[model samples]
Target chain A: MIQLNLHKTLSSTGGKMALDLDLTIEKGHFVTLFGESGAGKTSTLRMLSGLLKPDSGMITVGGTTWFDSRSNIDLKPQQRKVGYVFQDYALFPNMNVRQNLEYALQKNQDNSIIRELLEFAELEELQHRKPETLSGGQKQRVALSRALVQRPEILILDEPLSALDLKMRIKLQEYLLQVHKKYKLTTILVSHDIGEIVKLSDSVFEIQNGRVIKNGTAADFFGLNKTSAKFRFSGEILKIQREDVIYIISVLIGNDIIRVVSDPKEAALLRIGDQVLVASKAFNPIIQKL
Target chain B: MSIVCVEVDNGEELMSVVIDSPESAPYLKKGKKVNVLFKEMEVAVTTQKELNISIENRISGVVASVEMGLLLSRLILETNIGEVIAIISTKSLKQMELVERIEVVIMVKLNEIILAP
Candidate 1:
């Protein structure tokens, strides 16, 4: 369990923003900090990683004290069991992929983990390629592999996938989930993309003006079900048959076929292959994760 | 009567209630607007929080008015979304100690909601 009571003050164009937070995240849970810019999302991650200082309060992880303002106990970034992956993929330009992983090793540590990480991230072929030569996805994989070389307790990701394209981002999301489960590490992420947030996080903390305004299970917090009258898969029209004045539109949804009742002209403009929703009065909300 | 319950967004809130088939209520389509209609007697109110039951349609509101009678009582609940009217047995109403302005949770069963377009 990672528990924190953090307070910080920072100056922005909007004036002094006070970041006061008290949040408890369960162990092994992937939590995302979501908010607009200057909302103090990134600062929270920095404080946890010991890169940024808080004005006051304490941070504890799994019965170990990481920071306490009163006791003046502040561990160095290296002292805390943390692996931080930045948005820019902060790979060492001078070193290749393998060397970057080697750099995170402790003094006199075994080099076998380097081979393991290289193979795990599928960077065995690109082990000698410099950061500049690697694609955005390749560079991020290297960065992720390098971070895990420490086998840290908490993995901190600061918008790490935001720089990549949609396809790459999706591929990286799968890698992240695999890594999170394999290492059993508590992960904290800062992200703006709601799609990724929904895909990756078990819980979400929505911060605004430096405080956590909303926090809950990801589905409950973001999934409002505000769309049309609750058609889970909103089917597509495959065929339309005239039954007197009314029309029966055949809808092909996934592998199932559900027909919809429609009047002439839609009640106007519903054609074949167009997405049609079959809303039934009996079709009700079945509480499920979105 | 054979019924169909549909959910409606009354500009401020999404109200749902129902039982209907595609043939019974053909007006209900995806991305279309509809009206929600349910009975006052169908609205159930309680003061409990974070319940784990199967009621899907719910709202938190305060009693706008209460008309007490010997056998039954009528309650008008005012929520940010809209108002909900409820009718309950006077005996149960007295047991719950309900009064005007008292915050309460109103719930409706899935089949109780009716949709009209």
Candidate 2:
């Protein structure tokens, strides 16, 4: 299990506050950190990665003690087996897609692993393409491939989908799930979009004013009341289309075609011509993707 | 005469009201109900302005268009206010909730706004 107890303070455009958090995540778990802008999500990630030292606290990953203010032990980021994917899809502009990923395999030098990552990311054809030439979705796939190339014990992703356009975001989300399953790496995702957290995270940690307010499952995170009417109609699965990272599915219900926020699994079940049911108290069906 | 516009998403449509303020512009409450313009183009008490944490409500719409990976979904509204655009993240078709239209009801917290003369 990954246990994190951290407290830090930083001055930013947003107001400042004391950040105190204590979290325990099981192995192979997908945990998402969600909050509004300046909620300290990025700070938490920075502390874990050793890029920023905490004011005071302890951090342990996979039985390894990374930081401890009391014992005065702090490991450099390079020594920690961590794979980080930034929100902007940080790929090398000077290098092609292939070289960008190859650089990540520093000591291991596993060519076969690189090939596997390329195949999994559906980039076999674009391996030689430069980062600038590839589309946003393609670039994200490359970033994901690079992050996993090292096969780090822990994966850190900060708003990985926020930078992509809707369709690319959805496509990359599916690819991310695949990578998560294939590697089973303990992953931590920081996102401001609530829907993204609901769709991708198994567990969600709500951060506010430099503290974790609540930690619960995806359903709980959305406050799904068992008595609510969300299940009144088992909305039919429709045909799913991928633009880039966003998936748009068309469903036929009575005569209305309602679109809801979704992932690849839901999109795949939808057929171009099919019927689906949707039920909600309020008829405001606006999928706001931030 | 003083005028203020208010937008309300009561379950489905995005309704708007433009009416004369009973109090001075300084005393007008943004979220509180006041007189509003009705269909007859006259002032009515049925309308109200919402000043809260988030000004807009959350709703589901149809994926009308997609360009360069950005998907644009059009929401069918029942109000006179018109359409709104929201970005979504995901690719799973099963969770897509593919009905041509879906409705959502969101809670509104109050806020404060000043109309400039």
Candidate 3:
């Protein structure tokens, strides 16, 4: 279990604010911190990893005190068992794919994990390719694989898949789940993807103005109580147009963008770049072999 | 009708809210034997044991197994009454920890109980 009671003064584009957070994530459970940008989601992760200093409060992971303001105890990032994956796929520019992962290992650490992770992430063929030569998705797979070399029990992902396209992002979500389950890691993710949160996280914390305002199981927080929808597809809104008293909304699902007709009210609620779930009855589709 | 469903691992009690089971009203009695009939859409799964709700008949069962889909999830519950099958939102299953071996309470309304003489 990880317990965090942290206070930090942050300076960002939105202005300075005092962040106060009190949260607990059970072991082996996936948790998400969600909110608008600069909501202190990233800051909280950084503090927990010991990258940023918390002004006061306690941070405990599995009964070990990582930080205690009253007692003036703080562990360095290297001392804490944390594996961080950033949004940008922060790989070393000069190192090849395998080398980037090898760099994350501690001195005298066995190199077998590198081979295992490469195969697990399907990066065996691209191990020799440098970071700049790999595609965005491949780079991300490398980043994720590298994060696991240390076998850290606490995995922190800061918008790791937000930069990839929809298809690639989804493929990587599977990889993340694979590593999380295989390693039995307690994962903390900072994300804004509602569908992803509902699919990946056990619990969600909604942060606002550097404070945690609402927290609950993903189902309750998003009001995902409607169990009647049997046919559902998550996609992004690309365009909205009107046709003869009705609205046509275009959604990008996987590689194909399909147009769905929606009522005027629901069309008005959707905007470009918004993630949406196109749901209907199960028997509506006529499947054909191509 | 005797509904025979094979039980699986998740403990012994799971809860599902069954509705829209409008039975033949003439068949219900203390000493009468009747069959219950309902469609898959009529059953809803929940975790509440005791609460204020419209459901009248509560059958507590344990989650036996789950077949998960993209949006909906199918769960089999083993109870003293019998094995009940329910469909629920996938999100609810993941968040509620309603996997195999977990005890849950399944509920149904009085009017939803169909009785066939």
- lDDT string, candidate 3, A119-229, tens digits: 999999999999999889999888888888888989999999989987888888888888899999999998888878877899999999989899999866775433323
TM-score of chain B of 3: 0.69
State each candidate's clash count. Answer: 9, 59, 16
- Tell me how far the alpha carbon of residue A79 in candidate 3 is from the true structure, in angstroms, after superposition: 1.2
lDDT of 1 by residue, A1-290 (tens): 99989999988899999999988999999999998999998889899999999999999999999999999999999989999999999889999888899999988888899999899899999999999999999999999998898889999999999899867887899999999999999999999766677778999999999899998886556642332233334545778896544466788754468766554545368777674445433354466788
Q: What's each prediction's TM-score?
A: 0.61, 0.58, 0.68
DockQ of 2: 0.05
Q: Tell me the tens digit of each residue's lDDT in model 1 across B1-117.
A: 233334344444444543444555565555666767555667889988678888877788899988777767778789755777787778878999999888898888766565555
Predicted model with the maximum lDDT: 1
Q: In order, what are the TM-scores of chain A for the candidates?
A: 0.79, 0.79, 0.91
Looking at model 2 chain A, which ten-residue stretch has the lowest summed lDDT?
Answer: A225-234
TM-score of 2: 0.58
Evaluated against the true chain A, what TM-score does chain A of model 2 have?
A: 0.79
DockQ score of the complex predicted as candidate 1: 0.05
